[model samples]
Target: MIALAGAIGTGLFLGSGKAIQRAGPVGTLIGYSTIGGLVICVMLCLAELSALAPVSGAYVRHAEYFVDPALSFAIGWIAVYGPCVSVPSEWVAVSTIVRYWTDLHPGIIIAICIVVSFLTNIFFIRVFGEVELISAMLKIALIIGLILFGLVYDLGGVPGQSRLGFWYWVEPGAFGEGYLVGGGIGRFCGFFSVLVNAVYSFAGVETTSIAAAETKNPRRNIPRAAKHIFVRVFVFYILSLFVVGLIVPSNDPHLLTSTGNAAQSPFVIAAEKAGVRVLPSIINAVVVTSAWSSGNHGILQGSRSLYALALEDKAPAFFRRTSRWGIPYLCVIFQSSFMFLAYMSLNSDANTVFGWLSNLTASSTLAVWVVVGTCSLRVRWAMEAQGIPYQELPYSAPLQPYLAHVVTWFSSFIMLSGGFYVFVDGHWNVSDFFSSYFTIPLSLALYLGWKLLKGTSIVPLEEVPVGTFIAIARANPEPPLRKKKGVVGWFGRFWWD
Candidate 1:
């Protein structure tokens, strides 16, 4: 549920307008679907390993054990960095989202959101889970309702609106003029731009296992959640974007003028245009909740990543301190401090700040996924070298190292090319360019600095200790997943199991 909430946030409800504006209707679908496929591959890879290990930092721990300590050190900090910037991005979304109701200063809104999300995480883990679970349910309900609303409105099921049946797609000719250049090359640029936004939308799928150490029967539940993430991404994210493209024209001027309110949402734009006055406020309200939930999700992941680093002696020992309820209060406080970065929106346009922050988050997330893919491949190689059969694993993802290779290479390409438009004639922006490629050098420096300083070497495939963890899982196996019974069971399938 937390993962679901994390995956469907401002990127879907708010930032997607930018995607449609740049990519056009068909291009939006294509970009989301392509990135969605890559996310699925990475999720499955993480699922197989996480179900076996089920540690606090998920892949970070896996990399340390199965890959190298230095790689883990680099990627661990990157993981922490993901949420530090990401939460503020969501808070920036909150600043704009609340604009639907009023023009309250974004800094004030940022402070309120930071306080609320911080308090939510300062409790027991279950309290945080329930909050996210409710947020997830609300988000799922909102997207499904919006998708249905889009279909009805587009087909002229609403009393007065005329049928829109791909009118935007037909008129816009199915793609936006490419970004830097225009015409054919611009069309490609537009589609490529959507990839980064899509990465931001899908960033949370890989985080499901970060809570494995805190989850009950995580070996079973963690894989179940990971497997379900792809479906959620498809149904909620891809389908929602498809519906948005249908009802709202890609060329709508409102798409580009992101006011950080419901006015910027494509669905709200459709609703207001079609004389459905009430829906925009409602959509905006839910989106505010969605963005706030995403902020909470980011802080949770960030603090846990920091805590995991301390556990591995990769960070200051103070981060390992916890409350009686097992909450990492120190780590949470440290991460919450980064939320002040949201105040940057007070100085710049909230939309511009959002773009910068989202770009940074997406780039770092791509780097983390690359490391995850590497860890997945290493795990497979270790298993092979140790003569362990796949059947012995608690959960096994099909396709083995092939999926890992494909996603790793693809993510690397996307990460490197994220700022390609900035280099094109008449399109260069120094800040934008750095946001795209900054993580590349930062990650390399961290890896090399640690490797050179510590003289750490990659663990040989034959000595990765895969068998030790496998034995631990075997010794203390979890109970089988309970079967749902009768009406309650049917409801459980939808709400949560």
Candidate 2:
């Protein structure tokens, strides 16, 4: 549920409207499911590896062992940087929500949001986890309720009108004119645009392993979490997106509303069209908390990532300092220091800066996904070449290197093509172009600079760290899955404890 919460927040609650508006219903589904496929590959490979040797910086540290120090340095710092950019973006979002009621200064709201998120992480790690669990549960319940209510409303239960089964689909057609460039090209471009939206929406799928060391039963629980991802993601993202698609037309101008709340939500838009007056406000309140939840998630990830970098000696030693409670106090503080970026929202042109930051975040995340697949390929090949059997693995990902290969190329394409819009003839703007493609160059600079400066080379295929990790996993056997005695046991078995 925490993983799901990390992935499904303001992106779905707020951004889905833009997706449907751009790609239409069918296109939106295709985009999301495509990215979901890639993410499944990521999660499965992550499960296999994290179960073997659950570490604080799961992928970052894994990249160091299985790939190269250069790559790990690049990825580790980017992992630290992801939340630096994301936390403040979320704080800005909180201020945007607050603007609906009071005219309180945006800077003040951003400061408060930042401090609140920072303080939450400053406490005991378990306390932060508990709060996150509660937040995740609330989000899960809200989404489930919204999906059910949406289904009933679509069937015309509330207003006693005729059933709305696919009515909006037929009227607006399956795909919109998109950017209105005309027929097929425009629709294809629209769908491609939504691919980024889908990527952003599924951003935090790696959360299961992000804090691997903290998990008491990581060998068992990490895989368990990964296995549930498909079902949970399908129900949460696909079902809700389909419902939103059904009730709201792709051409609806209201979707483009900059209300910064549920007024721009497709779910709320559908409810209003059905004459429901109160659901929008209820959902609007959830939207604010959703942004705050994202910020909280960022802080947790950011601090842990910095701590991992310090452990690797890739960052300052101060970040390695831990309190008596086992919290990496200095690492948390280091990430929290960047929270002032939220105050950029005080100026009207902050969107320009925020947009660039968002693209960088997206690019870094996409690169990490690609790196994960790469790490899997190297490790799997090494294990196989050395005569190791799949049965010896702690958790096995089906399809082996094929899944990794596909996701590797797939994510790389997204990262490379992020700046496609700039090449759209007249659509080129200096800021937009730089925002899209700058991350690619910046990442190369980090990787190559580290490689040359440290005189590091990629680990040879046969020399990958598969053997050592296998031993570690073997040394740490998890308790057998517990069996419960009643109907509640059945629920626990299928879902969770």
RMSD of each candidate relative to the true structure: 2.8, 2.8
Q: Point to the candidate with the largest TM-score.
A: 1
For 1-497, candidate 1 gives per-residue lDDT tens digits of 67888888998988889999898988989999999889988988888888888887888888888888899899999999889999999988888878778877777888899888888888645677787889889988888899999899899999978888988888876896556676988888889999999998888888888878889988888777886877867768888988888988888878877555558878789878778778888888888888988898888888988988898788999999999888899999999999999998888788888999999999999998898899888888888888998788888887877999978899999998988888887878988888788899999998999999999999999998878888999899899978788988887676533
Residue 341 lDDT in candidate 1: 92
Error of 1 at 408 (Å): 1.0
- lDDT, each prediction: 0.86, 0.78
lDDT of 2 by residue, 259-295 (tens): 4443567877877877877877667677677788778
Q: lDDT score, residue 88, model 1? A: 93
> In model 1, which residue pairs have backbone atoms overlapping below 3 Å?
96-260, 178-186, 178-187
